[model samples]
Target: MKKIIIIIITLVLFGSCKKDEPAPIVVPIITSINPIQGNPDTEIAINGSGFSTVVSENIVKFNGVVAKVSSATSSTLIAKVPISSGSGLVEVSTSKGSANGPSFTYIPDIFVGGIESNGSKFVGKYWKNGVAVNVTNGTNNVTIYSIAVSGNDVYLAGYETVGSVKVAKYWKNGIENILSDQSKDAFCYSIAIDGTDVYVAGSEFNGNQYVAKYWKNGISVSLTNGQVSAEAHGIAISDGNVYVTGQEALPAGPLVAKYWKNGIATSLTDGKYDASAWSIVVSGNDIYISGYEDNGVNYARYWKNGLTNALSYNGNNIVDQIDQIVVSGSDVYVAGRQSKTALYWKNGIAVPLTNGSNLSFAHSIFLYGSDIFVAGNEFNGTAKVGKYWKNGSAVNLTNGFFDCSPWGIIVR
Candidate 1:
């Protein structure tokens, strides 16, 4: 009888202990994320369960960098992408546990190349998404004429002063690659890249006169015979053929607009008047050149497959020049200045980008999707400012206190 009573008491004690214990906490489960790719500060939505109702208690991260969480609930939350965050998986944490969502990708940035004056020296720089990166060491005067980006590599073509001589060079991600030997004065005005081969077009002083030349993988090829003054201002590579455009000064005549195909010169003008080509582009088998001809007055013009088409009226007392040309699909775009006003021509139709009140010039043009981007400088009363226009809206890249000029732009 005594043993039976003790056994019942022990069973009753065990039942009471089990009833008083608490349940286990459930871990947070991240299910999905919207808009898998974006730039910094982009808001993203996360859906899951077992999250904290309080925003501060929930933690979010992008590629190991902490993201700012604006709001949070048990099943949903909103967070902003962090700056300098690389592409990686996003994770969310709570008091229960942590869970990872889908991977997020960063957008390819925009780059603009130009010259920045620092006190007494001019430095070569390229702005990546509005952040400035110096290409030169700031010891000598340098100018960056053109910029191109392929994959993750950035290439800039320009010239830097070496002692008393100007040396043509190209910079690959801030590392200088010399194209000229400094034996003579040289200038690199344009650059084009094809796989592993790098081409730069410019002019070199050869004893008597400036000779138009280009360098392929650091090997020099003369486009001119070194007999008269000539210059190669633009370069493009398509279908394994190299094309360059510039002006060739005849013995007693005017500078003629000319283009070279694989080192063979073809005249675009009759050389009866002064003319020069500043930019060139090749699409399919058609070649487009942007330039100006002095027919009593300067007039902006472009040639399509060697057929000249004027962008502005001839002898209209409007000084104009086309500095860059780009083609997208069947549309042709040219950037330049018309009577001190920035403008771009699309299929020979002029679209004014700036008012005629202030002096502005567009030096480079790029197309991304349906958006057009132009880079150049604008005079803000006291100083020239570096800026770029996206779909005709201007965005200043530098403060107006300093003199800066954006000569090239590339959006990826």
Candidate 2:
């Protein structure tokens, strides 16, 4: 009986020992760090998981300077930002592994930047001299598409929900202007500033058809009142001439790429397939627009002085779009995403900017002096963290917390 009882005790002890065996240790993921850092002693925000166990051996550095950790949560560690001794990416190290964050340069306050759309509604924030400005105006019911800055006041164009209807409206300094107060569908997608007057291009529904329209200083002008279902998605003004680009759906079931120079609509496509323009830029009256055309396969393309150029034409690709365009000196820069990769083109030369094959996209581009900045997202199958690319290297901006995306870029 004693031997049998000892055998049972040993069996129970063995079962408890197996349960007590430690599971494999999971290393924390350092998904991102701030790319454009703040001043010295500024708190560095780190995003990822498994950071709570980092105590003594773990260290974070910014451009070779050791960073002092302030506080650490489960997935984030805040550290005092170190002074940059050189230009390089910020790196972090633990006893288990290492990761790199995007790079940053010391500068003044983050400036008055533009706004971008994240799937549904447009959201973002900016600062001047380190003071943050409200971008959303505390509303999630509206979709803001375009923004322009002129001195103190900021102008925005988008659709605001009126009951169940989404009506197009413009905001001057965050005050909503009912320019074309229609109870039907309408949206403003582009805005440009010339001196004190603001110019906006958008689409409005007139009875049964949608027409491309422009608004100047709260007054509306329809470019194609009700001739066809034409929508304007981009707008720019140079030397008092307004340029707008979009697509006009023809009766033959093909949407041709169209642009209006001072209310004169010009078709840029040969009507072979469907085409749409996303962005427009003007360099000395030579209009350039970036978009995509369906030549049996969707290709990233743009029109320069009535000339068509394609950026990608290889894959069984069906959709590629350019979201923004900027001209720096003699160079023309276009930014958008292709095959879920953050893509930028310099004078029509394609460049892919991303840290890895993880899902990344470029939504906006900025030119500060000679440096180029691209803002977008880096996705890891599930979650998408905001990413910023300077030159060609990408920097993780969100640090992998609740997910962040950069829609606009500007330097002050």
Candidate 3:
């Protein structure tokens, strides 16, 4: 009996000495990613808790593309963006568990910029895949005429009217940068970003006439001599050369469609009719410009390398207007209005976007791979409706409760 009591005590003591099992590790939770978007080989840090301490045990993927991790800890991990990674949710996996972080938008996402009226005033806005980013309040009238995205920065060109003064400005990631003060009214009609340089083309009031001008990094360079009313409506950069297209108002004559290369003007039309150039694009050794001319008929046309081609339509007593132009590979595209309907042209063939029951207009065009996108507006019986068309399908950006219009679109 004494021996059995001693054995029971030994067993009890052994049981008491046994170690308690470790608590199960919490699942890995991802709180954020620094500099969420970048090209291949871009190092990004993932910040969160419950990460594996062993560097070799953590796995990171960007849209299914495996990322090479450099270091790991309980709350952080550093990884490089995998080559050929597209935009999608970023996931981090560990032995404990896996977690999803915020979506990292790949560079070259589709962006649209424009304005919307809210019964009282006009507010400027831009969108990244239908998510609205309001750039202004309705206190003053503002417009966003163009959009350009480079790296992780977004630039918008337009003007804001404060009382009687029109202010030319551009927005970089929603922060306004003023280009014109109250000295004279100004309008920024187009913007082009090359590396870190910002170029804007427009017109600023010069005493008795509006002078066509282009600004490089906010430094003004006049394209016309301010002797006549002129406007620079479109800008393009290629092969270390700057090209701007618009019209020069001839004294007591019609507006002439012309383009300037490095401040030298090239006439595209005879001074016999009112012609305007709205957009320009340079591809290889060719230059393409789109606009309209009133030669007894309002004809929508595009000029290619100083040649001309008219976009055809079959409507009686109707007018056509071309607002934007784009060129891809061997194809040329233009967005504008046909009669009272919004439409686009591919290689000079008209593709309608709306029925002719109300007034509509197409202002911008963007091509992605094999897909075509056009931003415009349609009058929905009661109000103006903003629209973005993919291929032939239309996506309305706003309900028909107020006036809204999209003027610029870019699909990187």
Note the clash tally of each candidate: 0, 2, 0
Model 1, span 1-412: residue lDDT tens: 9999999999999999999898878788888888889877789988888889999999999999899999888999899888657789999888888998889986646899999888778899999999999989789999889998875688999999978899999999999999888898999999999999999999999989999999999999999998989999999999999999999998996999999999999999988888999899899989999988888754778899999888762235355667899998889899988777888889977787888788998999998767799999899997788999999999999898878989999976
Each candidate structure's TM-score, on Cα atoms with residue i matched to residue i, is 0.76, 0.66, 0.78
Per-residue CA lDDT of model 3 for 25-142, tens digit only, reads: 7888999998888766678999999988898899999988788999998899999886547788889998778899988766545688999988988888888878889888779999
Lowest-scoring 10 consecutive residues by lDDT in candidate 3? Answer: 312-321
lDDT of 2 at 192: 82
Candidate 2 stretches with Cα past 4 Å from truth are: 1-132, 137-139, 313-319, 380-383, 393-406
Best by lDDT: 1
Which sequence of candidate numbers ranks them by TM-score, best first?
A: 3, 1, 2
Better of 2 and 3 by lDDT: 3
Tens digits of per-residue lDDT, candidate 2, 246-273, equal 8888877788888998899899887789
Predictions in order: lDDT: 0.89, 0.71, 0.87
- Model 3, C-alpha of 52: deviation from truth (Å): 12
TM-score of 2: 0.66
Show model 3 residue runs off by greater than 4 Å: 1-108, 315-318
